[model samples]
Target: MFTSRTFKINKICEYLLNAKVKRCYPKHILSNRSVHDVIDVDINGVKLIFPNVWLRDNCQCEQCFHVTAKSRIIDYNNFNVDTKPVKVTKNSNSLQVTWDDGHKSKYGFNWLKLRSFSPKYQKKYNDDIYRSPKIVWHGKDFYEICKKHDYKDIVSSDEALHKWLNDTSVYGVSVIEKTPNSETAIDEIVKTVGFTKRTHYGEKFVVQNVTNTSNVAYLSSSLQIHTDLPYYEYCPGVNMLHFLVQTKGEGGENILSDGHYTAKYIKDNFPEDFKLLTNVQVEWSDVGEEAGNKFYKLYRAPIIEIDSNDEINRINFSIPQRGSHFPGSIEDVVPWYKALKLFFNLNKKFAAKFKTPEGNILVFDNIRLLHGRNKYEDSENNVRKLIGAYIDWDEIYSRLRCVKVKLNLID
Candidate 1:
C-alpha cells in the first residue's frame, strides 16, 4: 500500500535501527572511481572491504568453487578483472551480491572478516594455521625440563603420545624410557609418530665401532658436535637413537646443543658474524661407500638458513662433510672461518653432556640440535651399540595434528 520511495526509506530506517551501521556501499550507486573498486560492508561492528575483482574471482557458487577440495574452480582465462557487482544486499549473517554477468555470490560475515587484508586478521590466520612456535633452550635449563615418556604409555595412550610429540616440537628433544633393547625398538617408537625415513643407510643403521666404518658415528673416537646428513638437499628431520648396549668405559657420554639457541646468541652478540653465516653459502659433501653402495652427495647452503619471516629455519655445519670447494670471493675466507669457529665453540660450550641409559631412546630434532659422542673403548666386554633412525618433519607434524584433533586440542 506504499510507494517505492516510501518502502526504500522504511528499509533504510529498519537497517539503521537493527544494525550498527558503519559504511555499506553498493557498487551501482558509487560514482567515486576509488569507491567503485571495492565493496564495503559492516557487520557486528567489523568492517570488511573486498575488492571487486577478488569478490568475483572468489565466488563460492558450486560452478566457481569445489566444495570437497575447498579450492577455487574459476577459470582465470575467462575471469574479468573489472567485474563489478550490479546489486549488493546485506542479510542477517551474510552479504549477497549479484555480479554484472548475472553471477551470484554469497559470503558469510565471519568468512569475509577472516579473509580481510588487515594485519590483525592476517596474523590471526597465520597463528591459527601454522605449527606451534619453537621454544629455544640452553643446556642446563633444557635438561631440567626435558620430558621422558614411558614407551608403553606412548604406544597405548593418545594423550601421552600427544604430550611427548608436543614436548619434542617445543624443546626439540625428548627421551622415551623403558624402550626395549632391540633394533625393532626404534621401529616401534617411530611407527607411533610416523614412518621411518629411508636413506642410503636404509631404514635403520647400527652405531657401533666397526673395522672399516663409512661414517664417523661408527667409530669409538670423539665426534665433534654436528647435525647428520648436511650434504643432502633434503636432510632428515627427527632422529631416534636407541641405546642397546651402554658403554661401561668413561668418556662415552652423548653431547647435545640447541642450534637455534646458539644462532640467537650470535645474532645478539655478533650480528655481523650471524649475518655472514646466514648469507654465505658453503658446500657440504660426502663421498663414501655405505651398505655396499658407493655414492657421492653434495649440497650448498648457508650455514644458517632463515625463512621468509627472517626466522632461523635451519643450521647446517658439518666440518668432516664440508667440501673444500670455496665458491665465495677469496676475501671472505678468514671472516667466514672466524664465524664458523665461533659457532662451533659456542656449540661445545652450551652442549649438555650425559650418558643415556641402556634401553632408553634419545629422540631429537636433527635439524635443530647438534649431537655427538665422546671417545670410548670398544672391547669385547664393553662394546657400545646403538640403533639410529630418521623420520621427516612432515610425518611428525601430520601425526601431531591428528592427535591434536583427536584430543580436541585444535579444531
Candidate 2:
C-alpha cells in the first residue's frame, strides 16, 4: 500500500508523463501567506506563489477563456495590476482565490505546476542545446547511412511515407529508389509532401547540359559546393533531384556536406572565423537572361544565421551566386575573406561524395545540406539528366505532424 505522500508523487509523475491529471485535495500545507498583492502557498513540500492579477487573468472558466478556441477573453484593462487577493484557499486539486474586485478565480494545481517558475523547474539556457531537429552528419560514414524507400511504397503506404519524411527531417537527407524516370515522377514526390514551390525558374527545372547555359549548373562543368537560391528572401526548404539518366560517368558524383557540422567545426576550432561569418552580412545575387526570360534576384544576408535563442538556424552560402559588390566597411574586406576561406576549407574537408544512379531520387534539406556535383564532360553517347523541384519546410513539417498524429505518436 502506498502512503499519501507516495500517492501524490505518483500522481505528479503521471501528469508529467501523459497529462492525465487526477484532482485530489491538498493533504499537507507548510505555509500559506498573503504577501503584498500575491498569495504564497506551500503544499507537499513544494513552494508556489500566485499573483492576484495573474490568477484573475488566467481563469480557465468559459466566461474568462473561450472553451472552443481556448483563448482568454478577459479584457486587459479590467484587472488592476496591484489588486490583492482577499482570500486564498485550497479547493479540490486547485487554488481558489477571491480578488479585491470581488472576482473569483480557480487555478488547477496541475496547470500551475506546468507553468511553475520555481528554481527547481527553471532550466538555465544552454547555447549547446539545439531547439530544432537539425541533426548534423560528418565524414564518409554519412554515405553509409542508406534510408531508402520504394517509390510505390512511399505513394501507396502512409507508413512508408512517414518513415521517409522522418528520415529526411532527422538526417536532413534521404533517398527514394526505383522511381520512374519522368518529370511527373519528381512532381509526384513533391506532391506527397506539398505543392511545388514555384520560383523564378518556374515549377520544375531540368538539370542537364544545355546548348546556351545561363546558370553554371546547366553546363557539364565542376560546380562548387552550395545551397540553391541563397539570394531568395525565403529560400526553398527541401530540394528533390530525380535522376532520369545517369550513364557511365567518371566525375558526376554528387558532393554533399552537412552545413550544421561544418558550422559546429568552425565554432569549436576557429571561433573567430565562426563569429565573423555569423556577424558579417554578404550580398548574394542571381543575374541572368536565358531563353528571353530576364531575372536578377539579389538579397543581403549573413553566411551564418542564428535564431532568437542564439542557436545556429541556417547557413546561406553560394560562392558563385555571391555579388562582387562590398556593402560594408572597407576594413572588413580582408577579415571577411579570411573568414570565408576558413569556412570553405572546413566544408571541403568534411564533404562526402556519392552518385545517384538512374531510377534513384535524392531529397535533402536545402537549409541544412550544401550540395554540388563534380565536373564531368558531356558525352555524345552517354548523357546525364535529372529533374529537380523544391518544397517548403512548412508543408513537410505539417505532413510529418499529421503522420505522427495518425500513428498516435503524440496526443
Predicted structure with the largest TM-score when compared to the true one: 1
Give lDDT tens digits, candidate 2, residues 83-148: 666777785578777767788878777677655544333331111111125568885768665478
Measured by TM-score, how close is model 2 to the native structure? 0.77
* Superposed model 2: Cα runs more than 4 Å off: 1-132, 144-146, 290-293
Residue pairs with colliding backbones in model 1 are none
Give the least accurate 10-residue stretch of model 2, judged by summed lDDT. 123-132
Q: In candidate 2, list every pair of residues with a backbone clash.
A: none
- Per-model TM-score on C-alpha atoms: 0.84, 0.77
- For model 2 the local lDDT of residue 330 reads 89
List the global CA lDDT of all models.
0.83, 0.76
lDDT of 1 by residue, 1-411 (tens): 101111133444343345433233233332333423566667676655567788888889999999999799998888999787788887788888888889899998778877875556666655544567788888888667589999999999999998898889888999999987677977877888879888899899899998788888889999889999998888998899999999988878999999999999999999999988998889999899987899999999988999998999888978898999987878888999999999999999988999999999999999899999899998999999999999999888889889987887654
